[model samples]
Target: MGRILLIGGIGAGKTSIKQMLMNEQVSYQKTQMLDFSHVFIDCPGEYLEIPRFYHVLIDASHQVSEIWALQDATKERSFYPPKFSKVFRKPVIGIITKVDLPKANIKRASSFLNYAGIEEPFYTTSVMNKDGVAPLRMRLRELNELYND
Candidate 1:
């Protein structure tokens, strides 16, 4: 039950993914300072709180197992420097959301990944249709296996 941190710009569907995972019958606990194992910390996506929260990933607890960066496919790439990338330099994954919307920019998302220098695999998903979510889950499981092996 290692920590899995979900990152992205605001409205990138982090909460939606958290809610999806929470609906599963798994043990989870949340507190003011921190959220426990099998839990998701709902970090503020605003500009100021970004660095403050990401430092938690660098803890020596060996807790943060993965970093999932959610992206809004309908929008262009964020020009902000990838600060979170520096903190959670562990297994990273990209999640491109809003597949239901028109003009989804998967290529731009991939470009963003390339610009961020993230070699880890990524997936496109829509929580509404459940499209691409299963593959993401499978990829996470595969990553877990590889990490453990």
Candidate 2:
């Protein structure tokens, strides 16, 4: 897969999903700054929450092949404005995290992602339980192929 960038609000499972994708030590650590890995680039959630910080994401987008706009199903909030993904030059996808949470709302999460301008079918993943990530991996592979072609 080509380098992928993970963007989302705080506690939206960006770091956890990165661990799952990288097979790294699965633990929670608040990303203080942009954490670059071989497979993914994880950015702080505050960047998405504050419009002033969006420039960080815009700049980082230039370095990656794809952008994942994530939202946690467990918590519903409008962090992204209409068609926010369009801000990035790279292809943008949506991911719904914490799908295994007790009160997770997948439908609402999909709506939020759609509102944020993710054109393809958004992924729903539960990093803790290791569920639904395979599809995402497959999708990433597909994206990589298209990007390379």
Candidate 3:
């Protein structure tokens, strides 16, 4: 299987999503650096939050098969800038995280992703409840098949 790189703002649930997909115990923890696993590359949120660290993400993008640009559904602002995905040549998938939260706004999150240049069919997920996890997993599997074949 190919690896995926997760990028998003702080507390956007990137680590939680990685833990959920890897079937590891999901716990709240700050990512201090780049984390490499068998099927995922978990990036620190600061890489996306800081403009100078963008090169780190762009350089790291070469090692992964796909890039996931995540947006916290409850966050009012987006860490991603317009056409952010243009920096990566690989497929960039948009994901709306923490969708099960009471204050989550899927529409706004989707628009944020859209402005970032991530197209339609954005996935919504809530690691706490495992909502939308199955479909996202299936889609990842499909992408792996298509890329690795």
Model 1 Cα RMSD, Å?
4.6
TM-score for candidate 3: 0.95
Q: Quick one: ranking by TM-score, best first?
A: 3, 2, 1
Alpha carbon lDDT at 99, candidate 3 = 90
Between candidates 1 and 3, name the one with more favorable TM-score: 3
Candidates 1 and 2, the one with greater lDDT: 2
If ranked by lDDT, best first, what sequence of candidates would result?
3, 2, 1
Cα-lDDT of candidate 3 = 0.92
List candidate 1 stretches off by more than 4 Å.
24-39, 47-62, 79-86, 140-149
Give the root-mean-square deviation of each candidate in angstroms.
4.6, 2.0, 1.3
lDDT of 1 at 42: 50
For candidate 1, the lDDT comes to 0.62
- TM-score of each predicted structure versus truth: 0.71, 0.91, 0.95
In model 1, what are the clashing residue pairs, if there are any? Answer: none
Candidate with top lDDT is: 3
Per-residue CA lDDT of model 1 for 54-88, tens digit only, reads 45545622466677777788878563355446555
